[model samples]
Target: MYSEIIRLKELGLNISQIARHLDISRNTVYQYGNLNPDEYNQVLEDMQTRQKKLDHKREKILSWLKEYPDLSGAQVFDWLKERYPEIDISESTVRNYVSYLRKEYDIPKTIHKRDHEAIEDPPQGHQMQVDFGEEKLKNAQGNLVRLWFIAFVLSNSRQKYVEWLDRPFTTEDVIKMHENAFFFYGGRTKEIVYDQDHLILTSENSGDLILTHEFANYTRKRGFLIYMCRKQDPQSKGRIENVVGFVKKNFAKHRTFFNLERLNEDCLAWLERTGNGKKHNTTKKIPAEMFALEKPHLLPVYEKLNSTCKNSITRTVRKDNTIWFMGNRYSVPLGTYDGTEKVVEVMKVQENILVISDLETKQELARHTISLEKGKLVKNNNHGRDRSKGIDKYIETVAVFFNQPSQAKEWLKKIRAQKPRYIRDQLQMLQRSIEDVDVLITEKALNYCLKHNLFSATDFNDAIDYFGKMQPKERITRFGEADFIEIKPLNEMDRSKFETKPMTRDFNYYKEILERGHIC
Candidate 1:
C-alpha cells in the first residue's frame, strides 16, 4: 500500500489524490510520499507481515467462536484489545480484519456487541446521584434494628455524604438528604439525579411527573434542576449506584451502632477518611482534595433552605408541680401563680432548661435549672417552706408573757397541732389577761384550760369574772402568796365548784323568764 501511494505521488499526485488512489489515511499517504522508494517498500513489506499475523489471531478467534457459538464477538474483541499489544484498531476494523481472516482460514463469524451502546459521559458537576442502604442497630430493648441510610455522591468527584436515620426513606428523609448534600458539597449542582420513588419523582396515572412539593421548592430555591431516570434503569446514576455497593461492602459491612446519631457521625467520619481521603479512580487525585477545589466554584448554598429541624411536643406538670424533661422534672413557681395553662419552653442548649412561662400571655416567668436524672423531681426548697412563717416566728409571739421556756414549748406544740389557724387570737387573749392579773395567775388559767380542754378564751374569761365576784375572798397580792385554789383551779370539778351565788340581787321578772332554766 505504501509503495502504491509513493508511486502515485511520484506521478505528481497530492496527498488527497494519493490517498484516493491508495484508499488509506491522508497522513499515511503523505508519509509514504515523503519516504524513499526503498523505505516505502520496507514499510509495505512490514504492513503485509503485520496483516498476516492479524489473520492468524483473527482465525484463532473465529475458530473459537465457531466451536463456542455462545461467545460474543465483543467479548472476543475485549480479550483481543487486552491481548494484542501492537494492534491499534477500532471495533469495525477489527471486525473486517476478522472477516478477511475467516475467508482465508475458513472460520466462522460470531455474535457481536452491536446492541449495547457505550455509556454516555456525565457532564462535570451536572448531576448528583442518590441511593439508600441499610445499617444495623441495637434498640433500647436490645433487639436488632435495621436502619436505612440515605447516600448522595457527586458524579464528578465521587464525594459521598450519608445519614443514618431511624425514620424511613420517606419524603422528609429524601428532602433532608438533598439539603445535607448541598451543604456537604458546599454548593448546588446543575442537576440532581435521583432514584425514581414516589417520595421524590412519581408518575401519576395521567402521565404527569408528580415531584414532591418540598423537593420542588428546594430546586427552585437553589437554582438547580432535577433529573430522574427511567424506572429500574440504575445506569442513570451509576456513580452513586457503584458508591452504594462500595459503602455497603466497605463502611457498612459488619458494622453495628447503638443509635442513629452515633452511626451518622461515624458515617460522616468515614466519608472524611475514605470518600474524600482517597484518590478518585478516574481523576487520580483525592476525592476530598478535588472536592475542596470544586466546592468553592459551585453555586452557594441557598439562604432560604433552613438546615435546622424543630420538634414540638406538649408536657404536663406532675403532682409535685414540676414538668418532666429529658428524664427529670424540675419545679416551676408554685401555683403557676399566673393561672390558666402554664407552659415550659424547653430550649436545648448545652443542656436542656425549661423556660417557665405563662401560657396565656407567653410571658417568661422564671428560668429553672437543667435536669438530667430520670424521674428526678427537683423541688424549690427555698419556697417550699415559707421562712416568713417559720417556727421561730410563732415562738417569738408566745415568748412575750410566757417568757418560761417550758410554757413556750407547750404553747408551740399546741399551736402547731392547729397549724397557723387561730394562733394569733390565742396569743392576743393571753397578752390582755397578763396586764390585769398577776403573771402567775394568768399562767395558771392557761395551764388549767390546756389540761381540762377549755381551749376557748371566752370560757376562761367567764371563770376569771366568777372568781373576781367571790364574796369576802381573801386575796394575796404576791403571785406566790395568793390563795392558789381560788387563783388556779386544778381540775374541771374544781373549776365548777366556784359558782355564782343564787339569785344575784333583784332580777327583772321578764329577764328572769328569759333565763327560766337557770338556777339564779
Candidate 2:
C-alpha cells in the first residue's frame, strides 16, 4: 500500500487525486509520500532491532535461571525490579525471555503429574469442598491491599459460595465462614472436603489426621464428617480449587475494592448474575437450578451448631507466670506456672476478653481483659500472692498468739502500707521472737501497745521487758525432813486413833436427801 501510494504520487498526480484514484484517504497518501526510500528502509531496520527495557538485563536474567532453574519468571522479574529500579519491564516480557532462554540452553524442567483419579459426581448434598485464596487488589485509595477469601462449592450441583475477609482467617473465622456458607446454601453436606488447612487439621501422622480442637468440636456438634486431601494434592479438591481461581479471574480481577462491605456486596451481586446463575462449563447446567434439587437432600441445620466459636491457642506460661497473646503479656494464676514447659490454653472468647485455662485440668486459671496497646503487660495484681504466703501465715500466727487479732491485723496492714519492701523480713523477725517470749507477756505487751496505738516491733519488745521486770518474784520453798508428817496403817494399830463413824441407811434419810436434791 505504501509503495502504491508513493508510485502514484511520483506519476505527477496530486495527493487528493491519487487518494481518489487508489481509494485511500488523502492523509495516508501524504504520510507515505513524505517518506523517502532511505528513510523507509531505516524504519524497517529500526523495527527489526527495537531495544526492549529487558535487553540490557538479559545476561543477568539468564544467569539467574542457570543458577536456579526452578525459579519462575515472575520471581526473577521481581528480583530484577528490586535490584535495577530503572529497568521498566513487564512481567510477561520477562516470562517470554525466560522461556526462550530455557529452550535455548536445554534446561530441564520438572513435570508434575496428577496423583488422584478423575472424580465422578456424588449424590446431591453428599459432598462439598472448601478452600481459601488470597488476592492483592487496588483499593479506593489506590493503595495495594491484600484480601483473603474462603470458597465453598457443592460437588454435585456446582453451586459456589464465597466470603471475603480483610485478614487471614483464624480458627473461629473459619468456623463462622463454614456456618455462613451452609446457611447460604440452605443446608449442610454430609461430608466436607478440605486441603489440610492448619485452621482445621494440625497434623497428619502416618495417614492419621490430627484435627485442631476447635474444628474437631465443630464437626462433632454439627454432625458432619470431614475429609482431608492428601498433602500437595490439588486434584483431590479440584472443584473448590477451580472455584477459587474462577472468583479471582471473573469477579476480583480489575475490580476496585472501596470497602470490604461494598466489595462483598458487589461479589454477591456478581455471583447471582453470573457465577451461579450461568451454566457451568463442565456440567452444562445452571448451578442455581441444580442447587434447588440438591437442597432437600442436605442435612437440617441443628441448633447445637449455633455454639460460640473461639480461637484456641496453646501457649507456654513464661517464668514470670504470664502468657503471650495478641502482642501482649497476660498474667495467669500464681501456681499456673509449674515450669517453662507448662502449657496453657488461651481462648479468645470475644474481642476484649481472653480466658486462660490449665491444659491438664481444663479449668480457667485467669480471665484477662485484652489490651488494645501492643507490647503492654496486662497483669492481675493477685497473681504473685504465693510469694507472700509465708509472711501472711506468720502474721496470722502472731495475731492469734497475742489474743488481740484485730490489733495485730491492723498493725500488719500499717507495716504493709509503709514498709512493703521489708515486710517479709519484718514478719520473719516477729515470728522468731515468739519462740523466746512468754505468751502472757507478749499478750500484755500487745495490749499496751494497742492502747497507745504503737505498732513498732521495738516498742512492743520494750513494753514486754518493762512489764516483766515490774512483776513480783515468786517465793521458792525447799522441802526438808522436819516438815514431813508420819502416817500409820490401820492394821498396825492406827485404827484406834481413827474415829469409826457409820451412818445407817434408811428410807426417810434417802427421801430427805432426794428432796434436798443432794442424792437419789
Candidate 3:
C-alpha cells in the first residue's frame, strides 16, 4: 500500500527497501510516500476502488478458469472471445486475473500428466513400444475406407516401424505386427508394450493382465515381456505415441495407397526415411546412429519366425453331416465321422489353404485350395466320385454315398473319379433287368461301376437300388426267416407258354430301358 509505504519511510525505511518489501515500483513509493494527510486519504480511497475492481475481475476470470484448468491463457482468451462477447477481455487481462486468483486462492501447481509406463530415463535397447492409429481415406471407388496403422518405437533411439491394415484390430493382427517389427529391428527387446486391444484383453484395468489366450501363448513361446498402458493413459507409452504422429505427418500426409498392402509398403519406406533415418530430438544423435548401439542387445532374428502366418475366420464345417463355415458348403470325410466336437479350425494361415483338422488328435483330415471369393465352396474331397446328373447333385449324392464309407468304398474305389454319364449308364443297365424281378433283390446287389464317364452318383444309387430289388432272397442267417428272392428270367411254365424276349446284353438296350422309364 502506498500510504503504508509512507508510514514505513517515516520510520526510516529507504525507498529501495520499501519498494522491495511491498513488491511495488520505486516511482510509486516516492509519489505516495510524501503525500499530506488529506491527499493520502484520497489516494487510499482511489486504491480501494481499484483493488475492489481487480478483486471482482480476479474472481470472474478464476470462475471461468476453473472450467479449463489445463487450458492456456491465450486459448482461454480465444474461447472467451467467441463464447462470452459481453465479457470484455484481453489475454494479458485474463492472465493477470488468473495470477491474482492463484495467489489469493492458494491453488496447487499444475503439471502435464503422462502415463507411468513411460520411462523417465529409458535405457538403450531396453524397451520397444507398440500402438495403432486409424486414418480415413477414399478407396479407388471414392468410398470412405478406414485403415488401421500400427507403429512400433524403440524408447531410447526412437527407431520405428509402421504398417497399415484395412481390417479391425485382432489378436492375430497384433502378433503379426510384432513378428514383422522384430524382423525390421533385426532382434527382440526384453520388454514390449501394447494398448487395450480385444485380441490382447477385453479390459485390463483391475491390474490383472487378462491377455487373450492365443496372445499369451505367443509371448510365452517367444519369451518377451508384455506391458499394457492403464486405460485412457496415453503418456504411458509416449515414445510410440509421438512416433505415430511423426510417421503420419511426415510420411502418410499427402500419400495415397490403393490397398492395405500397398499402404504398408509405403509406411515401411517412410519409416526408414523419416523416423529411423533422422536424428532424434532427445537422443541428439541420428536414430540410425543410436540404433547401432541397440543392435547387439536385440535378440538375433529367429529362423522359424518366417513360418508364422494368419488366416481370416470365414469358413466352418459342422458335425451334422453338413458344412457351415462362413455360410458356405464344404464336405467332411463322411457319415457321423466324429472329428471331436470342437469347432473346426480353418487354417487360412497361408495363401488359400483350408485344413479341417480333428480337434482331439489335431490331425487334418480334409484340405482344399479355396477360391478367393468368400462363401464359394470348393467341393469336399471326401466326396470321391460323381455318379449324379449335375455337379451339385453329384456332390450331394457322393456326400450321401460316403455316409457309409465302408459300403461305399468298394463302389467308390471303382468309380474314384467317374463322370455323370458312366453313372447314368450303370443306372440304365440296373433298371432294365428289374422289370420282372423283385426290386428288393436289386437293393442288396453290389455292382461296382468304376468309370469316369458316370459323373452321377444319384444314378449310381438308383441303379444299386434297382438291382437290389431283383435278386432272390436267401434265408436270413440271424432271423431264421426264409427270404423269397425275385427271379429275373422266366420260370418253366412262363417260358413254355410265351417264349418272351428278355433285355439283350447291350449298352444301347440299357439306354432304351432308361428312356422308357422301366425303373421308377
Candidate 4:
C-alpha cells in the first residue's frame, strides 16, 4: 500500500488525486508520503524489537491471566511493575501489549465496559450533588477501621464539602451532614441531586419517589428540591462522584486517621487550603473564588432553616423513670414512666447534652449531660423526686392541716431524732391521711394525739373515734310562758330595763327542774 501511494504521487497526482487513484484515504496517502524507504525499514525494525521487549514477561502475563482471568489491565500492569521494577514501560504500553497477547493467545476478555456521556454544568448556585463513600484506613490505635464520608459538590463552581464519620450514615446523619455542608458553603442551591440511597429514597411508586421521612421533612423545611438519580447510574451526579474519588485519592490516601474529631478537623483545613482553594481542572478557576461569585445567586437561607440539625431518636422510658440513649441511661420526671413503656423523644443537642422531651407534647422533660462511658446512668438529681412531698413541705402541710404548727414541728424533730430513716415515710403517711379526713376532725384528733405524744396514724384515728363518742348531744325542750319574757314594745318598757342588769337565773332552780324530770 505504501509503494502504490508513492507511485501514484510520483505520477504528478496531488494528495487527494493520489488517494483516489490508489483507492485509499487521503490520510493514508499523506502518512505514506511522509515515510521514506529508510524510515519504513527503521519502523519495521522497531516493530520487530518492540514485539520482543516483553518476550520473557509475556509467558508470565499469560500464566497470570490463566490463573486469574478476571484481572484488569491496570491490575496486571501493577503486578508486572512489582515483579519487574527495572522494566521501562508506560501503562498504555502494557495495556496495548496485554490486549495483543489476549487476542493472540485466545485469552477470554472478562472485563465489560459501560458507555457514559458528559454532563454540562448547571447555572451557578442552581444545583448540587451529594453522595457517600467509605474507606478502610489505619487508625491512631494502629487498627484498621472503616470510615464513611459524605461529599457535596456545587455543580457549577465545583465547590466541594466533605464530612467524615466513623460509621454508616443514618437518615439523621445525612441531614446533619447536609446542614454542615450548607453552612460551609454559606448558602444552599435550589436543588440537590442524590443517589438512590436508603437514607434518602425509600421507594419508587408509580414514577414518584418516596423519600425517607427525615429527609423529606428536612427538604420541606429547608425549601430545596431533591433530584434522585436512577439506580446504578453514577454518571448522573458525576461531579460529586468524581469529588468522592478525588477525596479518597488525594486527601484520604495514605493518611493516618487518629480520631473522628481530629480527622474532621484536618479534613476541613485541607479543604480550605487545597480542596476548594486550589484551581479546579474543569472550571480552571479556584473553587473558593468561583463560590464567591456563586454566593449571591444562591437561595437565601431563612431564619427557620437555621434551627438545630441535631439527630433525634425515640426511646421508651423504662420502669425506673429512665430512658436509654446512646448506650447510657438518663432519668426523666417520676411520673414520666407509668410502669409500662413510655415513649419519649431524645435529641443530642450538643456533644455533652441530650434534651429529652415528651413525644406527644414535645415538652422538654429533662436535659442530661451525656456520659462518656457506656452503660452509665446519667441523672438529674431532682428528676425522680416528688416535688409536692418534700420533707419541709410535708411538715408545713401537716402543721396547717392540724392547726398545731408547734406540735407538728416537735413531732418531726422527735421522728428525725429517734428513727431518722423513717422520717420521710412518716411525713408522707401523715400527708396522705389528711387527704381522707376532715380538717376540723383531723385537727381535734391531732391535738389529742399530740397531747399524748402519739404520732402514729392508728393512734390518731382511735383518738378521733373516742372524742367523737364522748361529745355532748343536743336535747329539744318545749318553751312555756315562764321561758319567754313578755314581748313588750321597745318604746313602752325596754328602754329603762335595757340599762339595768338582768336578774341572774338560779342554779338551784335549773337543778330542781332537772331533778323533776321536766327538762326533757
Candidate 5:
C-alpha cells in the first residue's frame, strides 16, 4: 500500500487524485507522502516487528503472571522497577511490554475481588440494619432544600421504615426516629446494626463501643443490642445499604420539598407500594409478606420509654435567665426567665453538653457546653446579647416599610419566635428584602405570609419577590390566590406558637394596586 501511494504521488497526482487512483483514502495517501523513503522503511520495520525495547524482561513478566494472574500491569511495572532500579523505561513502555507478553503467553489479567457467599438471613426478628441518606429537593419556591433521612431494614424480612428531617440529625432526633421505626415495624429487633455514625457512637475504645452519653442512656433504657459496623464495610450492612439507595432512588429522588411529615408520608406510601411491597430483586420474595413471618419473632417494643433527659435535676432559673448548675449560671434562651416557668431540668450529655428542658413540658429548650469558670456567666453563643427590646424595635422598623405596622410587627414577631436562634439574621434579612421593593409589594408579601401562616423571614422575602414579579392584574389576582400557594415549612414548626393578628388591611392599597398597575 505504501509503495502504491508513493508511485501515485510520483506520477504527478495530488493526495485526492492519488487516493482515487489507488482506491484508498486521501489520509492514507497523505500519510505515506508525509514520510520519505528512509522514514517510511523505519515505520514499516517498526510495525512488522513486535520486539519492544523492554521485551527482554519477558521471562520475569511471564513468571509473575503465572504466579499472580490477578497482578495488574501497573503492579508488574512497579515490580520491574523494584527489581531493576537502574532500568530506564517509561511506565507506558513497561505497560505496553507487559500487554504484549500477556497476549503472547495467553495470560489474561484477572482481578481479585472478595468472594461473596449466599449467607442465610439471621433468625426472624434477630437483626435490622440502619443507615442514613440525604438528598436535595426543589420546593414550590424553587429553593434547594436538603433533607436528611434514616432508614431501617429488617435483615430477615427486608422490611423497611424511614424518617426524614429538614436538618442534621441529633442523637435525640435519632432516638426519636428509632422509636418511630419500632412502632412502624411492630417491635424491635434483637440487635440493630448501624454504620459508625458520630450521632450514636462517640468512639470505639479497644473492642468496646463507647456510645454518646445520651444514646447510652437511651440504650440502657430501651435494652437492645447495638451492632455498629466498621467504616468501609458496606457488605456487612448490605441490607441497609440497599435500603438507603432504594430510599434515595425510589422515594426521595426528584421529590418536591414539603414538610417532614409529607416526605415521610410519601416514603411510607412508597414502602407499601414499591419499596417493601415489591418482590426483592435478590431473594425473589416480597418484603411485606416476609415481614408477616418475622413480626411474631420480634421482641416486644419497650413500654414507657422515658424522656431522653434521664437522671435530670431541677435548677432554678435566675432572673438573668441563667440556670444554676454546680454553682455555675449558664444562660438559657432569653425568655426562659418568664415568671410562669421558673425552673428547667438540666441533664449532662456527652462531651459536657448541657441539655436544658422545661421542667414541666420536658421539651428541650437549649443545649450548651460547660465552658466558663464557676461564678462566671456561661452564656451560650447561641443565646446572644439581650435583644428582646431591640428585636421588637427592629421588627417595628421593618414593619413600618409596609402599610400596616401592627400586622407586619405581629408577623415579624412570628418570624422572631419561630427562628429565635436566628432572629437577628432573620430581621436583618427582612429589612434588606423590603429595602428596595415597592411598599405595596412588601405589604402584600407580609399579608401573604400571614394569611398562609408562613412565619419565616426567608418565606417573607420569597413572598415579596413572588408578588413583585406579577403585573398589577397579576398582583391582585395572585395576592388572593397566593394565600393558597403555601410553602411547606423548612422545618416542621408549629404556627400556633406565633401570635398573629387578623389579616385586615385598608382597601386603599388594593384600590391603588387595582389602578393601571402603578404604585399610586
Candidate 6:
C-alpha cells in the first residue's frame, strides 16, 4: 500500500527491506520508492478501473471459457476472428485480455493437458500414420455441409492421401480408404499408426487391441501391422495428426463442397500441387520428391486399385430374387422379392467377391464369386431355399377358428395349391373375414365354396357375405346337428322385398329432376 510504503520509508527502511516486509517485487518497490502517496493512489485507481478492448465481449468470452475450459488462447482467438471478422486486433492482444479475464474471474487451468516431445521420423516405407478429421464446408447450394476425411501421411516423406465422405466413416469405410491411400502411394508401409478410433477398434483391452471385424479382416488380408497410440497421446502419431489439421486448414478450409466425388478429385489434385509438391514445414523437403526415394522400399500391394472406380453399384432385386449385373444373375435372399422391386448395394471387393448388402440396414445379404460366363447364375444355395416356413402351423392356427377344423384345413390347402406364391396372404384375408362373419354363415360359405371348388379368397369372401344375413348370429342356434341348413344358390340371394317393382316412367320421373337442375 502507498501509505505503508511511506510509513516504511519514514522508518528509514530501504526499498529492499520494504519489498521483503511487504512480499512485493523489488522492481515494484523501486517504482513506488520515489512516488508520493497521492501519485501512488492515483496509479492504484487507474490499475483498478483500467478498460479492456474486449470488455464489450466479456460475457461471450466468459461463457466460452466456462463451457470449454480447456480451450486455448489461440483457439479463442481464431474463433472470435472467424465469427466476428470485423474485430480488428492481434492474437497476442486477445490472449492478454483473455488472461486478464481468467485472473479476474478465478478460472483454473484446463484438464486433459498432455506433454509433447519431438520424435524422430521413421525410416522410409517403415511406418505411416493415419487419422480422421471433419469440417463443415459450403456446398453448391450454399448450405453448410459437414464432411469427414481419413488422412494418411508417410512418416519419412510426409506424403499425404485423403479420402472424403459426406457421411460419417464406418469400419468398411476405413478399409476402403486404406486401400485407396495405399494405392495412391503405389505400395504400403510395413506398419501403420493411428489413434484408437472406434471405427478401427472395438476395445483396447488393456494393451491388446481388438479391432472391428471388417478392419481386422482387412488388416490381416493386407498383411500390415497396426500400432494404436494410447488414449490422449497424440505425440506418438503426430505425423497423421498434423496431416489431418493441414488438410482441414490448407486444402478444405475455404473449398466449397460440390459432391464427394468432386471433393475427392480436387483433394487428389491439391496433394499433387500444394500438399506434397511443396517443401514440408518441418522436413524442408518436397514430400512428393521424398516419396520417389521411398517408393522402392514400400511393400508391394497385390493389385493396383484405381481410386476413381466406383466402390459399389445399386441393383434392383428381381421378382425371382436375382440381380442382373455384368451379364450374370446373382441371387439374393428369397424374401428379397417384393411387390415393388427392392434395391440392394453390390460391392465388388478383392477380385470377384460380390458383397451384396441391404441399402438401409447395410447388412450383407449374400456374398458370391462372380460368374465368368455370361448368363450364368451365381447363386448361394441358401438364397434359393423356400423363404416361407411354418405355413402348416399358420394353416392349423387358422383352421382352429372354424367349427370343422379338418374341412377348413383341406379347403385352405386347396387355396394354397391354387395360390402357392400368395398362400400366406390368402390365409390372412380368410382369417380377417372370419372375424366379422357369424360362425354359421362362415360354415355355410366354406361348405358352399368347397362344393363349388372356389379356391380364390375373393370368391370365398363373396360367399360369406352373400350367405343371406337372416340374423346370421341368431341363426347359429336355429341350426342343429340333425337339421340340414338349406342355403340358397350363390347367385340367388332373397331380394324379393328389397327389389323395387319396375314402373315405366315417361322420362326420369316426369323430367322433374332435369327441370329442377338436380342432375349433372
| True-vs-predicted CA distance for residue 69, candidate 1, Å | 8.5
C-alpha RMSD by candidate, in order: 34.2, 26.3, 23.7, 30.5, 26.7, 17.8
Candidate of highest TM-score: 5
For residues 1-520, write the lDDT of model 4, one tens digit per residue: 8788778778878998888777878897777798999987897788777755577788899998888877778988899899888988888877887888888888887767887777777999899999999998897777888899999999998888999999657567877777788777888999999997766775655559876555677888888888889889887778898999999999999899888999999989989998999999887999999988898898875543443434665666888899876578899988888865466667777777889887667899999887879999988878866544576676676666655567767776665566566777777766676664444556677777768887665676687667655542321122212332345566675476668896899899989989889746
TM-score of each: 0.37, 0.45, 0.42, 0.41, 0.49, 0.42
lDDT (CA) for every model shown?
0.63, 0.80, 0.64, 0.78, 0.80, 0.83
- Higher TM-score: candidate 3 or 5? 5
- Residue 174 Cα positional deviation in candidate 5, in Å, after optimal superposition: 1.1
Off by over 4 Å in 6: 1-113, 304-520
Candidate 3, residues 1-520: lDDT per residue as tens digits? 7568867988998999999999999999888878888998897788776753345445556776676566566765676677767776567976665566667776643768744543364676678888888777777777777677888888877788887888655556777777888888888888888876555653464787755445676888889888888878787777788888886678766566587778777777766777788778876778877788878888776754432434422223455444555446566666534564333434554565667655335566677665656676667745544324353343334433232435444454344345334654543443354333332332243333333334344655565665654533542322335455445655445555476678669789879989889666
Stretches off by above 4 angstroms in model 3 are 1-121, 140-143, 203-205, 306-520
lDDT of 6 by residue, 1-520 (tens): 7678778988999989999999999888778878977887899899889988898989999999988877788888999999999999889988887888789898775888566767777888999998989899998888999888999999999999989998666556777788888788999999999897766775677888877555666777788998989999887777788888889899988889888899999999999999999999999999999999999999998784333423565667888899887789999988987867476767888577888888668899999997878999889878866545678889999898788889999999989988999998998998898875566788888899989889988998898878855444344521333232556668876787688787777786768877778654
Error of 1 at 365 (Å): 43
How do the residues 120-197 of candidate 1 rate in per-residue lDDT, one tens digit apiece?
Answer: 546557667778876675565767776777788877667788877774464555666777777777787787777766
Residue range 1-520, candidate 5, lDDT tens digits: 8878877777788888888877888877778888888999898888888576876777778898899888877888799889999988888987887788778888888876898887898999899889989899999888999789999999989999988899657667788888888888889988989898766775666659977667788888778899988878999889889889988887877788878788778888988999989999988999999999999999898564645545455566877788776567788887778774375667777657888988557799888787647776777766767557787777778777777788777777777777898988998887787776666687777778878999987788788778877734322222234333444677898888687777887999788778857645
TM-score of 3: 0.42
In candidate 3, where is summed lDDT lowest over 10 consecutive residues?
307-316
- In angstroms, the error of model 6 at 153 is 0.5
What tens-digit string does per-residue lDDT give for candidate 2 at 205-291? 667876767778888878889888999988778899999999999999988888899988888898899989999999999999999
Global lDDT of model 4: 0.78
Separately for all candidates shown, the number of backbone clashes (residues 3 or more apart, or on different chains) is: 1, 0, 39, 0, 0, 0
Location of the lowest summed lDDT over 10 successive residues in candidate 4: 474-483
**lDDT at residue 221 of model 4 (Cα atoms):** 84
Error of 3 at 249 (Å): 1.6
